[model samples]
Target: MTISIAETAETIDTPVLPTTETAKPANVKEVLAFLVSQYPLCFAQDEHIKPLKVGIFQDIAQRLGDDSQISKTQLRQALRVYTSSWRYLDATKEGVSRVDIDGQPAEVIDAQQAEHAAKLLAESKQKAAEKRKARMQEQRAKQPVKAPVAPSDKKRPNKTLVKGSKPVKAAPKAVVPAAKETIATVAPALLTLEPAMLAVGNKVLVKLGQTPMPATIQEVSLPDVTVQLGSGMVIKTRQDSLYQA
Candidate 1:
């Protein structure tokens, strides 16, 4: 049975070597050469060394500190300077074997692991989009639907009596006649006084229609006279409208 390099790396853990007080890797190039010799399956070399995993630099720093004189911090600082000169490693764009770093093509030694990581990221994004769509549907379900309004009935004028369909005539008003004038019959004693003698404040008998009433002269003129009747009713008429009393 033949074991693949990917399967072998997963099955066996990297053993922690004892620290040996000797000349440790002095630069990033020497440090990278040591890492490649220890874990040949975890790295690839083209124009430069490229890590197969995302945190390969950190893992190398920790492992190198265990058996080397260099501190993990010093190793990390050197790794930073080295990686900065290379292009950004994007797992999304570079799935599985081939990737471009610093405009140079490199290989992924752990191709299966890189492909698995890319698939997980794609599935996560798909699930998030589905959850967003479901939430939008739930919000729409909670909204109220408006009922349509009905139009009002407008009142129209009573259809113009249907054009001479026996036009209903209005009731006639009652007619009132004008009061008539009459000659008043005076007593023989009062008949002796002449109309010229009648002055304002003089008592006289006046005829209003057919009724003879006694009144006081309020004003006197040649033809018209104003008088106040016994009932306090005032009237203005010709001097002939009066009789001596």
Candidate 2:
């Protein structure tokens, strides 16, 4: 199957090939190509590729549940390849719409999903670059290394030629730096709170992330509570997400 993923834009498409009536796909690539052919609108190659809906594999599995030719394992693999493709990741940016089985718009991708897709694409590119650099280094290492040439007689006219002298020692090769190591750090946990703090008009700290912001509880519905943040922003969240002010 043809897979041309560009740096600026991803290109993942192949010429549609005829499928076997009885035999299963020989490999995952073949399976993906077949999937593209079956759902041309949902799955595409080159620049036209779009992001599939979340949990799309389950939907596809249910739809093609009766098809004996394509097994569930291969179908899942194909979907993985399609979703992880550079073009697909590129299309999963924020504000892009995901497509359903019939190629209809399912939902607009949110910022979280878009950020995750971008991270995956960056990792993929970094891996590819590392592999390419390794290959180049290997090729360079394989070629014959030339010996250092001796100084010409005219250039060293003041000094006599020594028969047993060794050619000038080649300068030492530059040392390669060690790969960076990731340092893991822990974030402080949220402050504990009592159940009574969930009442209306009670000022509590809402955990937005690592930092908690002060908000006055406006309404209490057991686990769900409505509060007005210190910034004048209103939000609804679970009781567990709040802490004592």
Deviating ranges (above 4 Å) for candidate 1: 1-21, 47-51, 65-67, 85-92, 97-245
For model 1, the local distance difference test gives: 0.56
Overall lDDT per candidate, in order of appearance: 0.56, 0.78
Expressed as tens digits, the lDDT of each residue in 15-70 for candidate 1 is: 22333436675545455445445655554333333434455556566665576666
Candidate 2: stretches off by over 4 Å: 1-11, 14-19, 154-245
Candidate maximizing lDDT: 2
Error of 2 at 90 (Å): 0.8
Clashing pairs in 1: none
Highest TM-score scorer? 2
How displaced is residue 226 in candidate 2, in Å?
90
- Per-model TM-score, in order, reads 0.25, 0.55
The 10-residue segment of model 1 with minimum total lDDT is 3-12
